[model samples]
Target: MSASETNSFRAGRIVQLLFGIAVAAAFMLPIVWLVAGSFRPGSEIFTSLDPLSIGTFIPPRPTLANFGSALGGAFRTGLINSIVVAACTVVVGLLVCAAAAFALSAMQWRGREVVFAIIVFSFLIPEEVVALPLSAIFAQGGLQNTYTALIVPFVGNGIVIFLMRQFFLAIPRSLIEAAQVDGAGWLRIFLQIFLPLSRPALIAAGVILFNAQWQAYLWPLLVTTRADMLLAPITLGLMVGEHTSDYGQIFAASTILSFIPAVVLLGFQRFFTDSVAMSGVKE
Candidate 1:
């Protein structure tokens, strides 16, 4: 290539790179504001909003008092409760989803496609539509304000099952047949082969389940009434009052709440993307 042409290409590439960085920073501004606001005093949070400046993104006198308050009392309990609930959901939900996916994809059974179609349709239905009825049923069953109410209702996630099934479908049938011919039972094959090979899909499914439970507000509100049983999101809501609000603590708590799932998603994003892409590729 000519020198001028090479220079032009480099200039174009630099422009694209600069544009991408600018876009990323724009998207990150809110998160940056949230994190910065967390360290500011409650009275000072909105003081600098008249004219946008570096002060808006940077707290002049930062303090840990908000975090101290946020991590204490009921909010702390809520955070722990959220972690426990989300973790339990991920573990149990993954098992149920993987097994259901294996059955639908590996085992040749009558009405398999129909069952999967039904499962696909099920997740599409908004949870808000079913929350009231489920809440009533749980109330009747005496499961209100309990971890069982939180965990069990979400154990069989259809989206996770669908994602796993798609990934499972991409697995070669020959592998399953070979395992069967080697005298491996269906259970053994699933345990040893499919599960091991589908780590990326499993991570993706677990992230989805964890995020769902972590951010759950409406269902928890419907099922749980006790202060101690509240999840982080619900506790955050309670932190606000009609008369007064603790903006600093709220920002700190929000930062913590957002950080956990963001870290999980970032850590597993490569695997998640790969799983989604491969799951779309059918034999």
Candidate 2:
């Protein structure tokens, strides 16, 4: 390459790197502020308006009192509840969605397209629009104030089923035919053949479902009135506002709660990414 061309290419690379770093810093600024504020004194959270100002990146003295208060107070109960509810939702959702996806993809049942269409169409109905009627049903069914109230309604998500079905559809028909020739029953084929091949879809679905249920606020708040029945992290962080506007404790609880999903994602991120990539590979 000519000298001018080489210099131009180098300049382009520098510009791209600079732009990427600027965007990354922009996104990280809020998280940085939140972490820094969590360490600051309760009184200083709002008082120190310019946390990123010169020489203010680090606090003078960081204390764990906010974390202590958050854990000691109602925040703790809320966090536990959130975990339980989210776990239940994830388990139930995965099982139901996987089963439905398997049937739709692997079986030669009649009216399958119509059934799948109905499932997809249900996604158009907003949750808020149905909350009132759902609440009434929960009350009538004696599910109110119970963990069932938080979990049952979310057991079958349309998006999850659709995604799983799409993934399952991509699996080669030859694989299923081979399994059938081996005298594998539908259940056996699903468990041994389809499930193994559909791991990426499963992981993708699990991550999305888990995150959705983890951060769920409106449904839980509406269904359960009692504080003791509330879910984990989110509930705890929310109650922080009700109990008192303790920004320090609130930020601390939020920071800790935020880490739960982050930790989960970090642990399984590789699997999730690989699965997504494999899903795009045509058989």
Candidate 3:
């Protein structure tokens, strides 16, 4: 290429980099403000709010009191509850969804399409539309105010099944056929061949599912009325809003709560990214 063309190319690349950085900063500004505000004194949070102020960038007098309160106060219990619920949701959702996806993808049963359609249709039904009926069912089943109420209702996640099915469908049919030819039952074929190969899809589904369960608010609030039963992390952060409007504490707790999912996402980011990339590569 000519010298002028090369220089122009470099300049264009630099401009693109700058534009990308600016877009990223724009997206991250709210989170940056939250973290910064959390460190600031409550008085300074609302009054002296300049997101980019270097003077306010670092906490003037950093205190762990907000974190302390968050850990020891209502947040502590709520955080615990959230952990329990989210853990249960992730484990149970993965198991149930995986089994359902396997069956849908591998088997040829009567009315299979109809069943899959119904499950997908459930996703279209807004949570708010079903909340009232679900609450009543929980009340009748004596699951109200219990962990069962929180975990059981969401165990069979349609979206998880859908994603898993899509991934399973992409697997080589020869592997499944070979397993079957070797006298392997459906269970053995799924366990030895399908499950092992579907790690990427599982990881991707897990990350999405965990995030959903972690941040869940409305259903938990409806079912568990007792403070002791409150889930940790998100629930606790929310309770901070109700008990005391301490913005600093709220921000601190929220910032801390935010990190849990981000950390979780980051931990599996490579796997999730690889899964997406691999999905695009033709078999």
- Measured by lDDT, the strongest candidate is 1
Give the per-residue lDDT of model 3 (tens digit) for 156-264: 8888888888788888778878888889999998888888888988888888788888877777777887778877644544654555578877878788788999999
What clash pairs does model 2 have? 78-231, 78-232, 79-232, 79-233, 81-231, 81-232, 82-231, 82-232
Candidate 3, residue 166: lDDT = 79
| Model 1 per-residue lDDT at 76 | 96
Model 2 off-target regions past 4 Å? 49-51, 54-56, 237-244
TM for candidate 3 is: 0.92
lDDT of 2 by residue, 154-187 (tens): 8898989998887887788888899889898988
Q: Higher-TM-score candidate among 1 and 2? A: 1
Q: All candidates: CA RMSD in angstroms?
A: 1.6, 2.1, 2.2
TM-score of candidate 1 to 2 decimals: 0.95
What TM-score, over all chains together, does every model reach?
0.95, 0.91, 0.92
Q: How badly does each model clash, as a count of residue pairs? A: 0, 8, 9
